[model samples]
Target: MTYKEFMDSQTQLEAPAHLTPLLEALWYAGRDEWHRAHDIAQDNEHDPMHNWLHAFLHRQEGDFGNAAYWYRRANRTVYSGGLREEWQEMVRTQLPA
Candidate 1:
């Protein structure tokens, strides 16, 4: 599945408000707007989803090391995890090749 599809599903499911910012971050990340995503992710410290988003942004910006670190800090996983691979892949594709 694509990142946009995953995001759309989350939106359709009425995902948590805390995760909303993460979605926004993903939206910005999709557009290669890391700063905007980072800005959105920075506002929420309490949500693991926010950390996941931060990690994704770092990954998208080519900071693979910090991205992994943040993902770990965020306790990221697939099932029941804060963020999923499809979305992460979406973010990943935004980075410069």
Candidate 2:
């Protein structure tokens, strides 16, 4: 899936079943379902990708300190961009060519 495809999927009632957990979380995030996204991220805490998603969730929640911690855990730099831009980047990175 491309980033445009992923974004387009948001118009549906549910996220596509083929998405990875991180992508599902991003899907939920796009819909403003923060708790669902956070749950998916927290439940998959062992993966660096999930941690990065968790960081993004915290950042979106306006909890910068928690976001920083999760970013460190994920070995990703704390994102300084707008939430929408960061979300777009993450979705694009996870999507298949």
Candidate 3:
């Protein structure tokens, strides 16, 4: 899906079925469903991308220390951008052109 389509999906009651688990977490995050997003991210622990999403969720929750830990797990630097910008970056990176 395109980034715009992904963003627009936030208005719907459910995430698009084609989305990966990380994208589903992002979808929930866009809807301000932090716990749901966190749960999805946490459950998909086999990927660094999931760790990245977990870090983003923790950062959004104002849990900097936990965010740092997840960022380390993801092998990523702590994000310095605004949460929305970081979220958009994450979504855009995962979306098809």
Candidate 4:
């Protein structure tokens, strides 16, 4: 789904059926369920998308150093600021509709 659409469609418990693992992670993260997001992201560590989402999850959990490590694994620069900002950037720049 489009990033905006995903943002809008928050009435459900599970991730959209068509979304990838990274998207699933993003969905759970947006709902403030870091553990759920982390579970999905951690399972697919070989993928850069997984690494990025995993990093974001760690960031949400207040683990900055671990987040930085995963960001490096994802080949992304470390980020700071509110979770919403990071989530929007990741959704817009990393995921597909």
lDDT of 2 by residue, 1-97 (tens): 7888888899999998888889999999999899999999999999998998899999999999999999999999999989988888888788865
Q: Tell me the tens digit of each residue's lDDT in model 4 across 1-97.
A: 6767888766786677887778778888889888888889889999987898888888888899999999999999887678789888878875465
| Candidate No. with top TM-score | 3
Tell me the TM-score of model 3: 0.94
Local distance difference test scores for all models? 0.62, 0.91, 0.92, 0.83
Q: Candidate 1's residue-wise lDDT over 1-97, tens digit each?
A: 4445644544343332443565667766655667877888788756777777777777667687888876787798423333346456545454332
Once superposed on the true structure, which residue ranges of model 4 sit more than 4 Å away at CA?
Answer: 94-97
Which is the better candidate, 2 or 4, if ranked by TM-score? Answer: 2
Worst 10 residues of 1 by lDDT: 10-19
Q: lDDT of candidate 2 vs native? A: 0.91
Q: Which stretches of candidate 3 lie over 4 Å from their true place?
A: none
Question: Runs in model 2 with CA error above 4 Å?
Answer: none
Residue 15, model 1, lDDT: 36
Model 2 pairs in collision: none
RMSD in angstroms, candidate 1?
9.2
Span of 10 residues, lowest total lDDT, candidate 4: 88-97
- TM values, all candidates: 0.57, 0.93, 0.94, 0.87
Q: Pick the winner on TM-score between candidates 1 and 4.
A: 4
lDDT of 3 by residue, 1-97 (tens): 8988888888999889978889999999988899999999999877999999999999999999999999999999999999999998889889875
